[model samples]
Target chain A: MGAWRHFPIFMITVPLLGAVLLPFLGYVREKWVPYASLLPLGTSALLGVLLIGRIPSGGYLSYHMGGWEPPFGIEIRLDYVGLFLMLVVCGITTLALVYSRRYIEKEVSGGRRTAYYVLYLLMSGAMLGFVATGDIFNLFVFMEILALSSYALVAITGNRNAVRAAFKYILMGAPSSIMVLLAIGFLYSVTGTLNMVDLAGRIAESGFTEVLIVSYILLVVGFGVKAALFPLHMWLPDAHSIAPSPISALLSGLLVEVCAFALVRITLSVFTMRASDLVMGTADAVGVAAAAAVLYGGIMAILQKDLKMMIAYSTVSHIGYIFLGLTAFTAEGLTGAMYHMLDHGLAKACLFLCAGNFIYLKGYRRIEDLKGAWGQMPWTCFAFALASLSVIGIPPTAGFISKWYLILGNVEGGKWLYAAVLLAGSILAAVYCLRVIYYMFFQAGKEGAWEEYWHDAPPAMLLPVWVLSLATLFFGVFSFLIIPSLLKAAAYLL
Target chain B: MKKVAALLFISALAVLLLYVVASMPPMGDPDNPTATHVIPRYLERAEEETHTVNVVTGVILNYRGYDTMGEVTVIFCALAAVLAVLGRERRGVIHGFVDRSEVPASVIVKTMVRFMVPFIILFSVYTILHGETSPGGGFQGGAVIGGSMIIFTTIFGLYESSRRIPLKVRAPLEGAAVMGFFLVGSLGLVGGGNFLTYAWPRVAQGLHPSLVVWLTVLVEVGIGLGGAMVLTSILFAMIREEEEIAPAS
Candidate 1:
């Protein structure tokens, strides 16, 4: 019981220490690299669950770095929102690490495998810190760690397109980082303290409305690009689709979502004042653009040639849903967004892992090539079908529960048009998500190539896929357990 | 039309940025929140609390050392990024990005570099050791050391550089920065203090001042070495490819 006291720092540091150890360990034994990478994330995930269990009823866990008070020292606070984000980060990353074992052998060159795992561990560790930290500048540092690792991971395949995509990522990503830095600068100037709770108390008192509003816009735009919100989403599909699949899973499933979580954290906690109508309009504008992204993503997803690319586009749509709920400014919307972050993370990660299996088993990249894929790899296709239903928000999966809350949230906020967009968007999701499921099970075109590779993915890869895919179903029926907690956390956002 | 749209957007952004700038508190104002609220505590008690002559170092290495730990990880990540993309350097290979001109540096140029390398290294060590008491710290010293590596490579070729700083030597040190944090922070934990706590009350009933000094020294050395190695490797990886890439045809 007392062990949970230092769990927050341990959760972040363990994986970082693993990343530091991986290269040297690679020299000792090549096979040890995969399991070595898994251990830290596995431990981080365990720590995360235990830490969440220890959360005092309605109270948060705070660790002040250097034993300094909140105003002076760096603090790591795991409130309900951060606890939820931490669970998603640690849990999904552990699964991704499990899947990366066999999949990375072919996708990454042998020499770079250690480097790839190192970046993956660093990215996950930074995300754990990013969510759990209570300080703003510390958040920026974690952002860079995560972002730099993501850029490296994207280009890890070392092909021309992968490198090009990663460059585009850095181009957009790096400038956005500077924008984030400027925003942090603006914030530090306005309020001397870098701590989030301290800033929340000081912001309203400072009353420098215009400067605060500008900084808020800067943070939003900066994180908006990272989250891949529309008009800012050009870098996502290529980067997500080109990387090896587990990396794709981590990028689509968690990285963009964490950026959005950072945005939500700053919005709800740091800047609670009604600085201006401009602020409201800005939120509304983000919501509107998210609506556009939903539709844009859905329509484009239907037309994609590549399987993972389609899932990447679907991620854009799901991101739209989260931001839609987020900007609606209703407790229902916020809860829905938080829930969607989990459900979407699980579903999308499952979808990509299944896609990776297809590529692993049959070298299936395009939708057309997946025709009769079920004949060869029944389990992956089955997992795909189950998760895609969630993506379409069917009645019995966790995605439906979150999507329902999203719709309910919009309606509660009187944002009827966005609510309708939510409905239409899912219908579009049905078309795109089901199209692949339909191809694998129904279509039998060009039978020889599809049937040539006639074995399912090995269980190492298949089990994680099934676990994620099934959780969507299990959570869908049982979401009531966590929904109240999510709603409570959302209410505290004010 | 695309260019026009981009220009228009950039202009709008500039205007917005200007508006924010116009609203900011005037720079160096005595009553600015940064001066009145943020600086005084750090400037006033930092030397006594962290025991470093340079207040900035005391603040960076002791109070907010976690951020610097993250920064070193970022540096390490950048190196990983380059290695992952271009691949690591092997002893006997050359890359297209490497200078391929047959003519080597003149004897005097090589001699001068060979002579200056020692001085450069000595100065860097001096900078790193005296970092807590002065303006230069791990990053500055590390940059100088890294510059020496690049210069040595530029004149003496990649092979000589590799021989001097072999993969075995460099591989382990690349993560020294993060490892340094883990070790130092755990020292705090050993005393029942929080992570990254260099010096705190009642830890070990009375933690020694020298222990805190040792923590900063190790962290500074770790960062200095980690940064220098990452930069050196990234440069080497650029010029040297593991499997010769067919010499770019």
Candidate 2:
């Protein structure tokens, strides 16, 4: 068939092709990247919509390698789970690209602007590959690609702190990646194939022993570092706080969410159901991950001064909710975890975008320095308020709906203590969100004329903040629309 | 005492490296029982598939091209960092490190080095080109070729090296190489195969086994070019820095 007919492959290729072509665009004109990068992203976003439609009717779309059928050759499977993540990745990536036009101009010079777009596209391609790959080894390779580019992108600002932060990210990321490699080695030793579907089938036949348990644990710890789950989250605050704002938005919003999605996918589809069949009652090991992530992330986020770092720490807290919901081991828990991922992705993206615009315009990242910013940048502050409300689990925002399902799942699973932690996490969210809101609106500035203090964000940056802020409410108010599909996806896992 | 301490340290490091190598399976043992993972698969397919004999090259260029892309970028980022830090200095300061008459390269040495550059480049290309059939591929050949530039910079001045090869080109060259690596790797993701799998039937059908090997070679060339450029840039930057810290005229 024609190359155009399989939009799925093109979805991954177009951005990459755009990345390759981006450098040459500079030769033609300086402005070429802004326009050229959009077309591929726009096309990839369009393909995501198509994939979503195809998945329900098609069961699962697997593209076999060079005509090598599954169980031997690598496959790229597009079921509901993969498509949902694809939508989030593409949606947020497109917004981040639009945001970067104005945001990047201020942060990076003209000479390096082309390189920024190329890194951005490479990061996106790796994430897409991470989600779509059917082989376990391929997933590790893609994870490195994503991590390496992000390390470069995070440090692209050329500040001392940015470099330091990027170094810290690499230090943690390198170990995590190596740990993942080691785990994959162990898994491959047991099962001859690196294809995950085939491994899952083989794992089911073999039964869960101590060796399998250790591998599962390694996978959790390794992926957890990337996912920023609780204790392993030492790198997130520094990396997130130091990166340029739009990059921070993408990092907090979708990057860890992708990692979480992979963890959920592997735990359920690859490790649990089959292993549980092999060794009954041992599914609780998977549940413990959710517990640790939720508990640790919540407690640490309560203690940060810098606004960006606080939000970054909060990601560690919020990621816990996703793990907790998943640990419940019910379909409802899985669905809630999935929904929580989407909710947090939107809420966090909005918050970071809003925070970024302020830092760009005002030149201060301290939470206290943001006092009365609401008066200065009403649009940005408004976006921040909406996102904060969503994060706080306010009704009719995406966070609340996800939180509701997660709490219900906890209760359904007869884990009242976990349910209470979920409630306490919401309260902590309220505390932090209100602190930012209170400082922005209530506290006086450092004594200046309103105009002197005023700093409005540009259209390029403001648009993404508002769009994601709207999506927070959109997912919350209309949680039902996506719920059925998410439920169906979760059912496949359970 | 200092000499004794230094000797002990050298011995420890040497022993550690030796231990690691000893622990690893022997170089081309196809039937090494420990070689059950992807390495064995590459060895089995190396000559039959790509026509080369070097198993390490075979794996580096074709089987794990994507990994090499990240490795290339690591060197690239290091080069960019060193350049960003040191590239701003005057050429005079960069050139002043060497005593003018100390290491004058002989005419024969110059002629041989110049001749070696193209052959080195060609051999890198050949390694990547024949990765599927042989053992040596993009990364090994690229390192060897890139090594020549460092050799050139050492004997010649930084000015000659910079004029011969600017770090600017290295940045883009690295970016393009990485972009190409991902593009090929994504084919597996797109073609109904796993990540980096050559799964698209229509695309695979049109190609002969040799042609598939050719495509693999194209990817290796990108890796080689990128790898060579990055390593040379790092070497140049290091030399330039050492030149700066020397006594001023």
Candidate 3:
């Protein structure tokens, strides 16, 4: 029962243990394995709810593995920030898995279904671990865990393009990993200790200077690739387009959020505000790069043709919003960025899932082909409309609140140009989102001028999509539950 | 041939020149005084607290378990990539070139290979398990397991080996293994410890800290297994030209 007391950890564990057990279980009936795999996650999600309620605000919680102390034994650390992130990731993961049951049964072959579940569970655990881990080196380990699982999950379709995209993702991903590893090596060479709290203390003791500046750059670039910050986001669209829908939801929704969370964690925790001021003379370079990402991602997304691919490109744009808020270096900016992280996650996951639903129901990929989809799958399209509105920063949607903070942050910083760019990016987002919406409702299907491509999705699919869609509005309306938590998380970081 | 040789020669020369340039550290080192930092001091102090022969492992598994989790995800991403790409093919009955010869495994070789599997797995487990107090880690263990799988594929036909453990099973196993590693790492979180910072006495009480360390190692073993299976399955599907592609349709 004490073991169950650590259910937060078990939520991550049951699925992980189940992963190892799954291969051996294959010797039994094949059909039962994916279902068996779902049990751990279902259990993990239930545990996650309990864990979230248990975690207190602004307080640190530590769980010893085998009872080891800091700088000696292994530890699992949780804060309100960590717990909240874990809840979002685990909760979405549960729904994604539920949706995957019917989706995979229809789309993937019987033999490969087990592998899909394995990769999916691995990804879920890795994302949770990424959020929960306290140590620097442990963060790197989780990064790889999530990276490899994501790679496999993306390639699961086994299309030639999936293979090619995975290969390219690796080509880009490997260097990023090596870069981060080298940065860690440099950090070790300088600081020695890899513990974040200890490292923070040591850094404070000495003082921030130039060499630390280089380390900051290295770490930013390293995490930047994962965070999809502008130039570094070249691999994102292709990778996202090629992966399966649930995998895409995991990737666009929860996985990248963890990476962004790492960036936020490192910037605020490792450097603290004082060190950040001293180290880079200001994180101005990061700020500038983030601004570029906003403009670049928005502009590039406007140019895409494929529906999923457009959403993928749009992710590049939205990530810019995350980074832009982060770089504001103000508490409001940071809080807004973190809040946007959750908001974008819900909105994007729904959008991608809806896109996948459209593709599956109708053999179409182009933005133009979505014409008349509203009449065919009204519920799905309505969900899409809500998610799209949320993403576009429409009033009464979650995205608007986050963007409002961002624009206000820019204005407060007296960087009116950045504010202008933010507004423009929002407009661009609306443009692309409306492109699909317009075609879906107004344009006729290929059957003829009057013909409509209308077919509602299975209840399983609609349920997850609508749930996320509604949450987008719910969070927008009652931003209070999360806004304070985001503020606390920001204070912890900033 | 001249172009190739010249390109190789130039590349080697460039590598040598870069090494020369890098050996100087940075020009502003004296003004910067990089080494006289406090984090370095803690690292210096780490040797006492960790009591591990290898400081690198001590920092990795114990000090920065969080980052190590991210690093493990990188490998997980690779394995997932392979699974996503290769696992979707339709398996069909043979209709093309077939291996007519029954190339049975020799008893001695089979015995040796069989003996080798447990030890390889054991050593990989040892590496990850002892990482807090030793040199190897999750990546190292995963590589070792992957190495063992290569042996399995070489001796057994890809078909038989893959059939024994299909991608469906392999994917879930991979997922669970990674999830398990994360879960173990997160144990400190639930136990009221920081993400990977366990207070040795309270969490373990009378138990040796090594017990907790060993659990982390065990988690790595699972990662190693999944990592190995995913990698081997991918390589097998890519390289193995069976008589017929499995027909999913």
Candidate 4:
């Protein structure tokens, strides 16, 4: 029990320690750094699996820093939601690190290679810390750690477009961070504690004061930018698409989901005690915005010519579905949201990795240019096709299970409009996802192009994509294995 | 037209923020919830509990050291980001800035920088060590140390500074210093204490109060050293010219 209690802190600290050691190791043996980067993430993923087993039996575990009890010291808490998110974070990180080896060696060179791995590890550790920590201020600290690393990673390619995109990301991201900081300040002033659990009780006692409302708005806008919520999602396509493929996978897969999860954690956990009207009002607002995002993102994605850009836009649309589930404020809805976070994370990462294989092999990102990819890279295209089906909520894929739950929640909540929105979103998703599949497999190609580019990705990259795509199918078919835990987490929250 | 929309947006946001700020409890009221709820415990028990007189330091280093660790990692990340963006290989000529090697440093400025560097470093060490009892701590002390290096570079130029403490030497030092904080925190766990908890009962029984104090000092020093190196590196990366690009095809 004693040993298990420290696992949450270990999950975060180990990756961070690895990140700190990477550059030095790079200095000593540059060849070894990429492989060395795997150790911490692999360990964290192992711990995450262990934690999933334990958290169900133990309920939530909180490890206070410096042995001080909270509302005093920072706390690292692992509930089912946090642990599940940690699993996603650590799992994706391990895969991305493995996938990055060949991609980074080919795309990035010199000291930048070492910097790439360092930032990757740091970003992963920061995301893990973001989900695991219980203190609001500590969450902000971790958010900045992740945010800064992401901005740098996006720009690390150093082309003119990438640099511009990263700078724009920083410009948009900084204000959101300040807004979050200010919201934390407001919450601290009112409750006099940074602890989430303590703040929840205090906020309920204080009632829905104007100050609290302001804090709520600040948090929504701040985290909204990071989550790429509609109207604030300007930075997502450029930043996510322009980054290296492995990084794109991480950013699109884990980073935005973590932010969305943070939003869910704050609304459902910290402000649980607020007036029912305010809570419902916040939900309505989020529901409407999410509905808008579903339509907007789907339509925009259909308009994109570049493959990664379309996927990035699809991320925005998928985030809407998660929000719709979240704002439904029902157990089924929350479960659906959480499940969607996992499902979308796997599907989207697979798509990005597949797209990276295409780009690496053929040196093109345009959808039209990939007309005959299915002939050359059958395995990669097959993975992409499966992931796209999952994204579009085809039956017997993970996306279907989450969308089913989401529709059930909306129907149960008596919100027919959101249900309609979900349907529209699925239809729109089909348009973009199938469009890519069509171009990849069905479209005729220019002469000699098919044979010239006919090569499969290295095993390192192809394997992870296949694993993720298959997992989507596996979970969809056998959701009973995961749904009970998701339900348990939801029950704990509501 | 774009300017107009931007102006309207900024003004509306400012107005909304101002309204919220006005509604907040008046600045620094002692009886405010922030002061009343959890702070009293920090104020009353910090000295006896954490054994640090400066409650802020105690709070930052002991009570909330995890956040401080993340902060150090943030600084480490900033340096990494700068390097990733600017550290491309080229034909000896730096990118982003014009070469300044043609200009010579003034004799008096060089002499002054040489004299000030050692004392500045000494004072930074004092600040880091004395932080538990006084106001100055790792971040401030680190800036002072880093500032000294910047001064050295300014006087001696980037070439000399690179030669003196080349990136090869500095990068590892910074990594090690940042890792030191994580090591100390994990060591607490290894010693049957919680993460970053310096006052484990087992340790207190063995080494007593000095161990906690020493742990605090160790973290402060680590942060100080890492911060100084990171700042110096950022300065170096910024001032150096862009690496010369390959000739256009």
Candidate 5:
């Protein structure tokens, strides 16, 4: 009740303060900037871990801003779901910052390094705010913070393609923002308050109105563009691929997942009391789009020659899995979706970091160019292989656990076809991932090039990649650590 | 073909939106749900509770202060983004105008800008300070300050304006302004109020009864300062050409 309640707010402000300080720190001593940037994230991650321990015992914590109760002041709500996602976001950010220490210096110019850290911190802090806030309008504001920072990060590379991709991303992104704002305006008209809990109750009493339906559609489409749902995913691949590797890892690993989390929060919690028929129809639409994404992304990934692009496309497919699980609307499915989000976040980040290491060390981006990469950097190749196994849903890897739950949810929902699609998607994933693995380990090197570049990555970069790879295996084997929280969260939502 | 398809897609979306708009409750209906619930409490008690007469100001700066903090951060971040995209290194000279030394502004225009800038800044400060009781607030006031700075830059040139507020000083000030906002918000926590909570007992202790109003004013000042610094930084980033790159690019 005392300072303990302040942790959620600190989780956001701490990073913000650090980000604002970074430019000056970089000016003072460039060496200190990277390490200084970690202070806020590490603190926030520790806070997240502490909150996780306290939340299960204490129930959800809702701290009102400015000491005014809800429906009057802004609230920071920490439920099992929010805390768990915060842990994921903060944990990944901490690791990415560590990995970026050496990577940013090499990829970004000296003049731009401080701005890179500043934007990185801003993006992560904004994402934390996005997940932790309870007010709907507050969520939109945080969303814009993250979105703007991400666009700039995407273009930070300043290559022709990077700039073009960032521009395209902005064009697509602007409408999504407008749609979300318009939806908020509609909801506000119907209900005077902007609190999520209050809106849910009022929406139920108001029944299924056309305004509500319109808002719901707008929310989905708005968030869908951000989440990179199949039809609206054009901006993701180029933006993800062309970014500096660490930024790529963060974008592919966490940004889209956060959007999906927003989608789940809106559909399940805020619209829980909507007309059953409308819910079913919306679920069907989401399910079909997810199914299409799984197949389409897998096929596109197989066709991709660039390693980063392939991984980015595979993200589209993995996002499909998360959506597929959520739209199933069962407790098992919801839990699966949440678990998959964590699993994919870890595995994809590992993959992107590994890809980045290759690009950094040898400047090789093509899959065929990576022939005999294992001979050069065996540890990195091994990590990539491990992460790919998880990507393909191989057993005893984290991906298998989520896929298992999703398939079970599909079966429980009597959607056998979705179950088949899930299986087929895994096989397709296997095809794309195996191609990279095969070239990395088995394919012949380009004469003596392997031996010339045959050195392990720096400890700073290798450490985070290995930690993430190990986490993928650890979570796959010991799903018990996280599944209970996931179940509790799923139960709360459904 | 692409244009036709785009046209078709947009029209379909527009028609759908129009349909939804038609079904919405009549515009500004007093008996509407928005008017019935939640707002009355705000309208009636906002002044007594938060000690601010302007309900919108009270709601934004006190009741929903967290959102405003996020908004300030967003603007600060946008500036950071602009700096990131455009190199932080100052350009050797401003682009889009003849060298100011070679082509000085006409006496009439220079005198006019010299006459106008101080008043513009003065008015902006007035608006920011009186925001708790008036319609004007940090965002508008900060924009006005930025506009005046722009005027200074345009009339006197980047070199002269930057010399007045050097990049070295401006960069840290921009960051410090946002840091101030974070520090102020954190005061609520220190006082055992929730984050950004202005009316906590501890915060109000030894202060006036209208402490919330004062705190609201303080936050608005922080926001105004931060907004002005961010706008100035963004302008600096945009106008300055990279020293290494040729203007013809």
Candidate 6:
């Protein structure tokens, strides 16, 4: 337990502790706010790297809070799945903070920047906690923290559109959050304990299968809304698109993915352990929903006109791929799904950061407006093209590697329909992403639109964008390095 | 049509929820999983292991302290969220509460609130301090403290109340709960147990034997202070709306 070096608890607390201190730092010295925010974040990221290496290859590191063991105190469990996602969360967050140093100043007004940093720290820390915790109720607590912060982050700009978007997000998010809480209540009532391990055991021993099935449904629907699964995703495009680009990136890249991961954890790690027929039977239905999310999101993305809006829709489509792979439950599918989380996270963050750069520099958010934008900002367009290629599942990009596994998994699971749907979704992704790519590189905007002063976004912005974009390509070519661990994780969950 | 659709959806959810509730083991059934497995430990071992007379306090502050910490952070986050959306309260600007300096409140109302506020605050302090031994704990006491502030603001103008608890005073205090968790957890680490553990080796110097009780009280106070500040700050932030008013003719 102590061997993980207290990385699990400290990693989460450090950021939250930083969040608590931020307002005071701002009050005492306004200039120190961003640096103070970055210190805890960097430490968390560093700890994430250390902890990932320390966890036993196949086992988890679980430490009881207050030294009170299970069925009593909360436990912090850092497994491969949680660790993988935490790194994704911490890594992208670190980059985003670096990116935000400048973007927040420009997008968010002066007085609100400290609040932005505080909320961002809370949001990132909660996301990390959501993945790492082994307790069901604790999961809900972390979810609330992340949910609240993200809602506020969405509306932080306080513009009419941003506020309206956050309102819609809350409208969908709040009730679902309650549904999730209610489902936890249902579990606790039936099972007595809130720890995942204990609940799984109690559920098997208990006679209340009916209650368990209903709780499962509620969790699916609740988490479904949180993840913006196809039917419940009406809130995402507006919320993601209207948020500051970094927030749009964070929401799209990690926040929704964390919800999806929680779904996987609960359904696979807990319910499936019971081998309840009703739950497994319903899971196939969730798979169908995931497939629909894939196609629907793709079509919606293809239909989108605004740059961030299109990427937002693409996230809907990409998240579909992750869920599709997860529901397949084959080793290949799960591996691909897990891998998709990483690749899509990197590619999408890059896409949004690049989008932010375009808006920040050239003031272009529309595809039509992006024409000839490359003439002014070559590097950003290149990063955008690379990321778009990944999104479109072009060969040798991270997206293609994961898409390959997803299709393989679908086929392995004998879900040819889903496999076909996956391929078609990729084509649809190509249609929208390639369209943006073309306008950026080939087509010309209004003659004067190309004329601008600064060549590209400041290095602060471009650095994160390129780092993320390169990671996608790097992971694509070097998929071997990560896929093995993902497969092992998939096997563990299966 | 919209109303009809919403009603249909809600009814469907209601039926599902009702069904789930009905299927759960009867409330307080001696044989229920909660009573059989998780509850007995907390109820039976109230005073010894965790050193709290209140089982609820033991379960929250010691047994499942992490979640309580998260809950407190959630409250802190709510304040952050509000400020992020509405922006922070700045000095020298009148908030959303319109300036009522021209028309003052009645003497009785002001004096009554002024006198009542202190006692209310004092009770809140008592509740917080004795939380681990009593039915009440940090959250309940903190909410009351926050309620006291709201009452004060409603009676005395927002400006006067804001002046009383200025930003500089409450800003650092706002982080008390989280910092308390960190501080206590680190001390537990130093005590060679684990983070948030109450036990320490007996020593001649420093708080050792009652370390657990003291830490619990410490966390309770931190939560009460932080929660009160957060609720107050949120009101201040939301009410701290900014606009320029022209000088009166």
* Number of the predicted model whose DockQ against the real structure is largest: 6
Candidate 3 segments exceeding 4 Å error: A1-5, A25-27, A273-282, A448-454, B1-83, B88-97, B100-249
Instruction: Let me know the TM-score candidate 3 reaches against the reference structure.
Output: 0.79
**Candidate 4: lDDT of A490?**
87
Off by over 4 Å in 1: A274-278, A452-454, B91-103, B200-207, B241-249
**lDDT, candidate 4, at B135:** 95
**Mind giving the per-residue lDDT tens digits that candidate 4 earns over A332-382?**
898899889999999999999999998887787999888877888999999
Tens digit of lDDT per residue, candidate 6, span A251-279? Answer: 99999999999998998767855355666
For model 3, fnat equals 0.35
TM-score, each model? 0.96, 0.84, 0.79, 0.96, 0.96, 0.97
DockQ for every model, please. 0.75, 0.18, 0.25, 0.70, 0.72, 0.86
Question: Relative to the true structure, how large is the alpha-carbon lDDT of every model?
Answer: 0.87, 0.72, 0.71, 0.87, 0.85, 0.87
Ranking by lDDT: 1, 6, 4, 5, 2, 3
Task: Pull out the clashing pairs in model 5.
Answer: A66-B197
CA displacement after TM-score superposition, residue A222 of candidate 5 (Å): 0.7
User: For candidate 2 chain A, which ten residues in a row score worst on lDDT?
Assistant: A274-283
Error of 2 at A61 (Å): 2.0
What are the per-residue Cα lDDT tens digits for candidate 1 across A1-494? 37577888999999988998887777567678998898899999998887765774256888888888888889998888788889888888999888998999878887788899999999999999999999999999999999999999999988999999999999999989999999999888878889988898888786647788889889999999999999899999999999889999999999999999999888877877645575587898999899999999999999999998999999998899999999888889988998899989999999999989988876878998888887888888899999998999998899999999999999999999999999999999999988888888898858377665558888999999999999899989999988888887777664
The digit string of per-residue lDDT tens for model 2 on A1-494 reads 43433566567656765665565565457587886888888999887786556677225677754344554345667777787888888998899889988878888765567667777876787788788777777688778768877887888877789889999999989988987887776676566567777778777877765556666766787898998876678899899988887788788888898898787778766785643543234335545555665556655666777888888878887888887887787778878888887878888888888878877787777888888787789899999999999888999898888898899888998989889988888888888889889988898877762345556888888888899999998988888888887777777767
Q: Which stretches in model 2 have alpha-carbon errors above 4 Å?
A: A1-5, A24-31, A109-111, A273-302, A449-455, B1-112, B166-210, B233-249
**By summed lDDT, which 10 consecutive residues of candidate 6 chain A come out lowest?**
A272-281
lDDT of 3 by residue, A1-494 (tens): 34445666576656655655664455456678767877888887788777664666667667654445554444567887787788788778877787787778777766567678767877787777778766777678777777777776766666689878988888778777876776666565556466677677767876654446556666787788888877888889999877788778888887777898898787777887453455344456666777787777777778988888888888888887877777776767877777788788899899988987876776577887788777778988899999999899997999999899888777776778778878888999999999888898787766752234545889988899999999899989998887787677666666
Candidate 1 local lDDT, residue A108: 89
In candidate 4, list every pair of residues with a backbone clash.
Answer: A66-B197, B94-B241, B94-B242, B95-B241, B95-B242, B95-B243, B96-B242
| iRMSD value for model 1 | 1.0
